[model samples]
Target: MSKAADNIRFVIIMAATLFVMSLGALRLMKLQLVDGSSYLQKSLSSNTAEQVINAPRGEIADSSGEYLVSNKAGFNAVIQKAFFPTDNREINRIILKVANVLEEENVSWEDALPISENAPFEFLPDRESDIARLRKNIGVQVYGTAEECIIAMTGLYETDPQLTDREKRIIAGVRYTMYLRDFSVSNRYTFAEDITMEAVVRLKELTYELDGVDIVQEAVREVKTGDVIPHLIGTVGAISAEEYDQLKGSGYALNDTLGKGGIEKAMESTLRGKKGVRTLEIQGGAVVNDEITEEAVPGNTIKLTVDSDYQRKVQTILENHIYWLNNQTSSKAKGTEANAGALVVLDARSGALLAGATAPTYDLKDYLENYSKVANGENSPLLNRVTSGLYRPGSTFKTVTATAALNEGIISPTDVVNCQKYYTYWEGWSPECTGYHGRLNVVGALRESCNIFFYEVGRVMGIDRITEYASKYGLGEEMGLETGRGVKTGYIASPDTFEARQQVWQAGNVIQAAIGQSDTYVTPLQMADQALMIGNRGVRYQTYMVDSVYTYNMEELVSKTEPTVAAVIEDKTGHTFDKVIEGMEEAAAFKAYTYPTVKEYYTDSYLLTELPKKAAIKTGTPQMTSKSDTGSAFIGFYPADDPDIAFSGFVEKGEYSKLMIRELIEAYYNKDYHIEKLGGRTEEELAAALSDNEDTDSFDEDNEDLED
Candidate 1:
């Protein structure tokens, strides 16, 4: 009975086993023949990624084809999300280790978290937007304190509780940066840029511990002629969150760098070349094959109108004259507070800026390293005074007065105006002149700079006619420069400007405005443009800084700037500007013969009894206040009979603006002046100099009480 049951059980068990085996074989055959290829394609696609290969940024050069800014190969530390650990604690550990390595090698990494590094954490000043972003990302209230946000970030990122506040802060910063960059398989986060080889080597040693970290080679901005024109060339830095949001649709990655200021920013579209793509195949958390699917295109090269050598000479002249003025002990020298100034030279016929120099300037590298110190330094070294500085034109405004008087037939060029040493035109306002010239015509008045003559003429023409002439000559107007923003459109001293300040425009204000006082303020660039218009007699041209743009290798031209007419002065009397030109010529002759200060400063070899070419020049000593020293200003055009170049200079609280005239003329006529070159001040030197220059005499351009 047991044998029969065992036999029956064996037969049933064999039959069941055979049926299960047949079903398993059929399923394996279907999977192997039909679904295998689909699953294999899915596995391959999941591991493959497309990476952006950034193109090299364009280079910048002066008009003479000398490189001002270029690019060099550098290494960057990157973190790939596909290979990173998913655990929060592991991510924190890896970031802290990488930060330690960077600190040891004296390398800087991107840590833009708004909280302070120490325990008594406070939000940094002027980082409202960043702080707001941090708060939102961490799910904190908008009004939450820095400490509260830090605590929230610490908890959210699962930072190590045993770590110090500083270590926790480091971890939080990297994690937040990752979040801001949208770090994922498609987008890699850049941990550090332009790192030293030492840092790269150290980071590589910890490759096993730092799972996601990798080294990448990229092109970094290399400043070649930073000292000559730092303010104009500007700088490049990491793209901000706001910038990323605006540029993301344009195929810009969060890790991309862009121009931060000046020409670099103005020409960003041309300088930032198109990006390329690289397709990578990953297997076992390692990149197995990488192929370039698209090739990167380098940016265009920009050619500026400025000649580097001439620019350097101009910078030296301004710096030297400013230095001399600051050290003067004579009572006649009122430049003890003259710590800053600007000088500009332009081609009178074309309005091409040949040279522009702003003193109390800084190096670009120093600015990139310690932006706060440079930005907030004494005298505002970051300020491009040539285009941004607003100063009283003083006697320089008389040019507009004479033009108005003659054009409107209020007074002829031969008509005489009495000078009583004071303009008693109004009862309470009696603005005095430098001396009592008794009576003088237009040419004589300009030669002697008689405030009384201009005051009488300005009162006759009224403020409307005066403003019309001033606008024609580009006074108190925009220069229409091709450079970046910050070009101020200063206003003329009229009822409109006074009304803008919510003040009454008194009748006597016209007398002051006639002499370049009251509310009239202008930049040195505008002054040069005025001189250029005077040289051209009636026509004014739009000024430009960029000359042309070319391909990356400069083999093909992209674009070129052409001279364009901006304005033409309308004259009822065709001989209006004739008298103004004669007056300026006589004024230059008067200075050459009577002014001994310029002759005393130059050696006999450099000095001359007469200029190489006749110049039409005028000087101004605009008073800031009764207590404050006056500002020195001068404008001129060379070869008065056949004007070639026009120039202007202004020194704060200086009384010797004429001293620069002779030297500038010499530089323009001779090529030797551009031979000598000098390097810019170092960061340490700049800091020490700024500290020593404490009496900056800050002047608020918008202050209502600032009267000349």
Candidate 2:
């Protein structure tokens, strides 16, 4: 009976084994016959090679549709992973042939390899880090020699068949560059950018032998404004390795271009478009199918608040004035040279920077070619004096003092103060004025920029009050231009600031501070904002040069940065800015008929009858350090009754006649001398057609410096 039970168990075990084997056979047959096409498709899809498609950078424009900076179609030579040879010796031979073809066609190819191609191989100093990174990638030590490093690279990349000395050198160089560029199987390499058409055609023809070589069409930054607004518009350059490393996660390629300075740098993220990707299914190095996995999003267009025409007019006028100031023999003054100057015009209500110009400037196109010349030249052209250049506000501060004094009840609008030409409130510390006006009210004091009147008022209000008003008007604060060195806020004379800078602020410092002298310094931009604030009756707007941002097609609105209030005067009544503006109106009243509110200002009256708009002005000739040389400053607003435009102009060492604040005002309202207000250009437009191309003949060019 035990033997019979054993036989039955064996039979059952055999039946179970047969059932399991049958199930395995059925599953194998299903995979091979029924689902075969799906598996095949999956297998082919896995062989795809990914490529990056760079998006065109955004075009920059003035508020109008005119473009200041744009992009043009550019040709570049690139390497394709699909066609690239796998053999090390073949790759070296192909790359050398590629280099030879480029050289023959007079086309430049960018090879960032650290080691020299010639014998006695040398490492480039500028590529030290790149070389070290490549070495570490190839298992080389930091102490290894350049040739040893090259030899080490050959073992990994140019292996299998032995490479000749020349072949080894060539392959090693390309390999090192590939490593530095963070090249991968998916990301091919960019050999050259902005190549000529002849080079492109030649490269395409040689693609069979060169293998992987392609001519890709791309966009290159083209400055539409030429040299006009070069400093403000800024420049774009090839991405550094450090930059690439920082942006790699964000899909940035090594050959990408980026803004290096000015507005370009400030608005990079807004201007740079999103990158796209292309995937190709390759079978035995042959691409059988291709697809766009992602679509590139074009960059948003940026519209600047600058009126190209008005800005050019102001720039030309300022330039011509400085040129005259430098050569004027009779008015040959001392102090800081007048080789540099700045002028800014803004919408009083909006704080829109309609125009801002800096002298000793260069065209945007010429920047690359003339970089060394401009950089090494005197009175730096790169320096945006509108915000970065600091100088004493001079007598312009009288308005601030007047505002504070009247607001704090230290002085009444009709109060009288004696300008005995000098004030001696402290013993052995008498501050003298340029003129000896006997007696003057608040209006007369501002009309003449009376130092004594402000000195006495400042004494009553104290330094703290003056500082409070200055801060309220956005003085000694960042202008928020974000245009690199063009937006730095200047220093204000204060006890805290003086202490921080390791200097002393004494009782007499308050007197000089009130007169826009002492340790106080203000930029032309700040002064312009001050003018706008005064014209707007204490409402200081957050000044901006850019107006709006749109898509490339102008069909979609990306962003619109409208004018917003930055600060406002605490005075609820018309006691502060209104009274100070009345004084300003008087200062601009060079003629009796135009603006009869204030007394006659001892300056030229050309703008009174000549321009379309009347102005309220204040003049300053502060001997920055000495009595002989003075910096010319003028703060004014147009149509004194209903202010439209506000202006601030400064010359390092200027005469009163060269201020030309009147001409700038007239140029804005009238189209006759409207140089900077013209529309910008298109992407395809040539540099010769740039706007702001006008003459300086219409305005009165005959004037010498005002006597201090």
Global lDDT scores for all candidate models: 0.81, 0.74
lDDT of 1 by residue, 141-175 (tens): 98999889888988998887899989988898888
Give the runs in model 2 whose Cα sits over 4 Å from its true position: 1-46, 86-177, 244-249, 253-255, 329-337, 482-486, 591-609, 623-629, 674-708
- Residue 365 of model 1 has an lDDT of 78
In angstroms, the error of model 1 at 383 is 1.3
Where is the poorest 10-residue window by lDDT in model 2? 594-603
- lDDT, residue 646, candidate 1: 91
lDDT of 2 at 70: 89
Clashes of 2: 12
Which residue pairs clash within candidate 1? none
Per-prediction TM-score: 0.87, 0.79
